[model samples]
Target: MKATEMRSDCPISSSLDIFGDKWSLLIVRDLMLHKSRTYGDFTKSAEKIATNILANRLQLLEDNGIIIKLPYPGNKVKGLYRLSPKGVDLIPALIEIALWGGRNISNTYDGSPFLKEVKKSKTKFLKKVMDDLLEEETNIG
Candidate 1:
């Protein structure tokens, strides 16, 4: 989809033309929240996104400047996904959504204790996520 073909001049609609679908944003959510960096990691998500859908969404995100694929330093044949600066900008939105859900959804988050802290301190949580991305070793003990 192109800006020229958008339904209207509404900014939200225009943005949706790129990532309006649940799968696209869910991919971003995974990247933001779970440190998922590879195709398999995304496939193993609880949502269990299908292989073909994941591939198409990944390509779509890359074309939109939301993410970039890089060759894994150790595995020549495998690729790792990383967020671009533009993608990093989505962190706050994710946090806000999470916090809202945390407040409204009962017995929410899958028993992750950190979520308690996140609901208390969104800034700190967002910082940690951003920092973790910067320190992407993809290989650690």
Candidate 2:
């Protein structure tokens, strides 16, 4: 979304403007767990996002520089999606939200190793996540 497209001057509003939709963040969450994913992978998500909406959200993310679309090796018709630096920056917020849910919601994530690591030491977990992403980025390049 462009600056003029924002609903207001508030930072939160601007962020919501870009990714307020229900599916965008889920898409980001999937990207966080996997360095790269395919369109088919997204379609297979438990959320069952429709193909059309998936295409639109993917386009919006790419347009906003939150994600990058790379050609799938040996498959001209397929593409791989990966988080951009801007997208990776959302990890902390995602982690906080996950923690909030774990505290207030059900035990859905109680068994998740990622949340366990985060609960153990958020700083260390975040550092490791960033380092891993950087390593993947370097290897990709």
Q: Find the 10 residues in a row with the least total lDDT in model 1.
A: 132-141
Q: Which 10 consecutive positions of candidate 2 have the poorest summed lDDT? A: 1-10
Candidate 2's C-alpha runs over 4 A off are 1-4
lDDT of 1 by residue, 1-141 (tens): 343257788987987887887798788887777554788889888888999999999998998898878886789877778887788888787677777777798967745766676776888887888888777634431
Model 2 lDDT per residue over 12-69, tens place: 9999999997899999989888778999999998899999999999999999988999
| Error at 66, model 2, angstroms | 0.5
- C-alpha local distance difference test of each model: 0.78, 0.88
